[model samples]
Target: MANRWLRPEVYPLFAAVGAAIGICGFQLVRNICINPEVRVSKEGRAAGVLENYAEGEKYAEHGLRKYLRNKTPEIMPSINSFFADPNRS
Candidate 1:
């Protein structure tokens, strides 16, 4: 009877089936999204999968700034600022 489908035991079974199916589908999606093999770039191409130009530019700028910051100038600051008495003549 149609009323049998509305029984309490049937609802729990249906709920369990729906939850299992939902979890399975979610896992499949997560695996596809996070799996390195599945998230690969085009065949033999040099470009990255995300194609994030801003990230690349940020790294480039960071490297340039770091290089300039660590490089020493030819002259020392103390020698350049040494006092010379012009009135000694």
Candidate 2:
């Protein structure tokens, strides 16, 4: 009985049928059942953004540290004070 189903000519038809069923199942899940919004969360989105910003800031700080390593340290507190003053147009 099983040998009758395993014949070479019948095998291709069986494979094709299996493939069609798999595709139908996938399409049903994709188009009819699954909700897109449920796959994403606000916390996940915020974490992604925060990680990206942190990576960018880390690279910027590393580059600054490398460049400043050989440069003389100067009094830059006036720069800070100027920005802090805010009243300066």
Candidate 3:
């Protein structure tokens, strides 16, 4: 029967493939709708990146990245700094 072909062992493989396709689809949609370069260029594609690095930085930043930009790099600041000093002296 057709159900025989749907083994539990293959379920993870199917999920992985589906997730990859979904991520690709999301990026495609985001770039098409939200990326400034896609809309700004007169022709179909930009010949090169923007001449100004700051301008490109301004355009490329997403909401989550922007929000996290100012936060501390450490996940657990106190714990990390404590262990960071390897010297026991």
TM-scores of the candidates in the order shown? 0.39, 0.35, 0.52
Q: lDDT per model, in order? A: 0.65, 0.65, 0.77
Clashes per model (N, Cα, C within 3 A): 0, 0, 0
Q: Which candidate leads the pack in lDDT? A: 3
Candidate 2 structure quality by residue, lDDT tens digits, 10-62: 98898899999999998667544333322255675465434355645554566
Q: What is the TM-score (0 to 1) of candidate 2?
A: 0.35
- Candidate 1, residues 1-89, lDDT tens digits: the string is 98989888799999999999999998689556654434445662454465666755664566558777866663665554454434443
| Candidate 1 Cα errors over 4 Å, as ranges | 39-89
Model 3 per-residue lDDT tens digits across residues 1-89: 86886999889999999999999999999877766566555563646654556645765886789999999998898788788878743
The alpha-carbon RMSD values of the candidates against the true structure, listed in the order shown, are 22.0, 23.9, 5.4
Q: Any residue pairs clashing in model 3, and if so which? A: none
lDDT of 3 at 1: 84
Least lDDT summed over 10 consecutive residues: which range in candidate 1? 80-89
Of candidates 3 and 2, the better by TM-score: 3
Better of 1 and 3 by TM-score: 3
Off by over 4 Å in 2: 33-89
